[model samples]
Target: MLDLRVFENRELAQRILMAITREAEMIGREVRLMHVCGTHEDTVTRSGIRSLLPENIKIVSGPGCPVCITPVEDIVKMQEIMRKAREEGEEIILTTFGDMYKIPTPRGSFSDLKGEGYDIRIVYSIYDTYKLARENPDKLVVHFSPGFETTTAPAAGMLEAVAAEGMENFKIYSVHRLTPPAVEALVKQGTNFDGLIDPGHVSTIIGVKGWEYITTEYGVPQVIAGFEPVDFLMGVLLLLRMIRKGETRIENEYTRAVRYEGNLKAQELIGRFFEVRDAKWRALGVIPTSGLELREEWKELDIRNIYRVGVPKLPDLEKGCLCGAVLRGLALPTDCKLFGKECTPRHPVGPCMVSYEGTCSIFYKYGALF
Candidate 1:
């Protein structure tokens, strides 16, 4: 078992924060570090770390929430696929994590679609879909696979399993996005940030080598960080020191799990079952080679082909919603005209307020929507 005492106590966190604040003051320059993990955003807000930081240091939330970035068009397409199956008198089940149920689309949401007589089931994992496929051979089980590298390895493993067992009724709606390309896009957009606090879980899969481009090409310092408060503060301090010295490099603070080369077996599995393709994010549109598509050998399991469904286009968000700007880091959640007035977490007008890890939701929960 992992050592709980080291990270459970708050003393280590306090010490790290003190060091970071001291280093920030010595630099005599504003240090802005962006964290690309939603969980880290929650940790920072929940622990009140922002209030503790020096005035010269700023921590901004990046486009890290998977649910927030899921394009509305994709959700609408999945809903349409379910509707088409029902009209043809075929039994179809759409399974996904419970967090994805409330993510809104242009028309409505999966919850709304389920309320309109669609079979949308919530399963814990892809293996559960295989079990459901075995129980009901007559029904088609399409799992909505949405996540970063942390969750893609298991989905890749499940695909290999389904292929070995020759399960024709089971398939996955692939909406998986990679981390490196998204970071590259953020940098190319010329976001005025000094450094990046890289995603630790994703780094465990893709490794530190994948982030070399950010430092070499984009000239931004990045540090892979863990979820704990001490780990995060240390990462911040490292980035600040690097910026102070005018150095840009890829550093890994979470050395226990992440390595230079990462997990090759997982990478091989992903390459075997899927190929890189262009995908649309709700806020950031059509990033090149950011998404994964199923391989041609597994075309038989493609839900779009099996059900003969057409992908539909969705309209842009209603006016006065700054979710797009917030995701792009051009604006904060409080900058929205309807942030706390019309777009509370209870009645979110966009995906940003729907997910718990979303920046707007985080701010709303901690009363930071000033």
Candidate 2:
């Protein structure tokens, strides 16, 4: 068990950093490790932990922010779903995370629709969405849910709740993604990351064994870790050790929250309500079975299947904005010309800037530390 006190100890933290630095020297080469969790990036940036790192160590952020990676086509599809429902005289309520509300689509943002008298509500959790459904039984409740295993598990559980309650008014347009397929896609593309600092939240839901494919097939090492600076440093050290050992395998450094089998109930709910499908990421494009769609039996509970919502032709993104590249770890936030100039947190020109978990947003807030 990873005690919380150990992580909070400044002296212990210093020792971990010292050992990590020495290990970096021992490896004696440039090391690229990608962490595909926005929360992990936030911890690294906010804690000024990157400044304590050795020179040759680089930690890159991958497709971690759910809102930043959602394809423009899906956003357009969301727009169409709400509009068509209103056109057909159906009262509808669209609920999603606030990040999704501000994310720019080809047409505009969901916030734009909100301004035009659309009934789009920003919800903090699926339970809040359920409450909305129960209260407005006459109105069709559309939940536009998106995230990795962490968020997906809850969405799955919500579906189970709906089925148990015999509720037919609620429907979901799931843009949920699985990280393994995205990671594998990275390997297939010959991405240069030598190892992975996997997301701890996702691992807690999917378990450590879910990542076996990374080492077994892609021949890459992965270490799951929590949000603390020590956990992340430990994960990096594990990766370097794997490199020195000339071995590729998946290991867990976040055992305090994660286990080998994960949350079996959450996994059961997910397996019951969802199936794997090809999902289009912003820059990485369509990854094979990387997305979760409602199961065939749950087709009636799926808005896309019920309404036949088609993808709309999206408008071109802002010229010279590299949010796509930034999400894929190919380019840093500073690489974009408009990052701090034309695009800031107040007025974001791209989706990456809109998401608090986004690399651009993190860089904009704390790039000076790096």
TM-score of each: 0.95, 0.96
Model 2 per-residue lDDT at 83? 84
Which parts of model 2 have CA positions greater than 4 angstroms off?
1-3
Q: Please name the candidate that would achieve the greatest lDDT relative to the true structure.
A: 2
Please report, in order, the local distance difference test score of every candidate based on alpha carbons. Answer: 0.84, 0.87
Identify the runs in model 1 with alpha carbons over 4 angstroms from their true place: 368-370
State how far residue 357 of model 2 sits from its true place (Å).
1.3
TM-score quality measure for candidate 1: 0.95
Candidate 2 minimal-lDDT segment of 10 residues = 308-317
Per residue, candidate 2 scores C-alpha lDDT tens digits across 1-370 of 5368676577878898888888889889998889899999888888777788898988888889988888889888888888888888886799999888998865888999999899999999988999999998888999999899999988988888899999989999889999988988988987889899999999999899889888898888999998887788789888988987788889999988899999999998899999999988876688998999988999989898767677755643678889877766788888899989999988888888988899899988986875
lDDT (tens digit, per residue) of candidate 1 on 230-281: 7788889899889888888989999878999988989999999889998888
Model 1, CA-based lDDT: 0.84
Clashes of 1: 0
lDDT of 1 at 14: 76
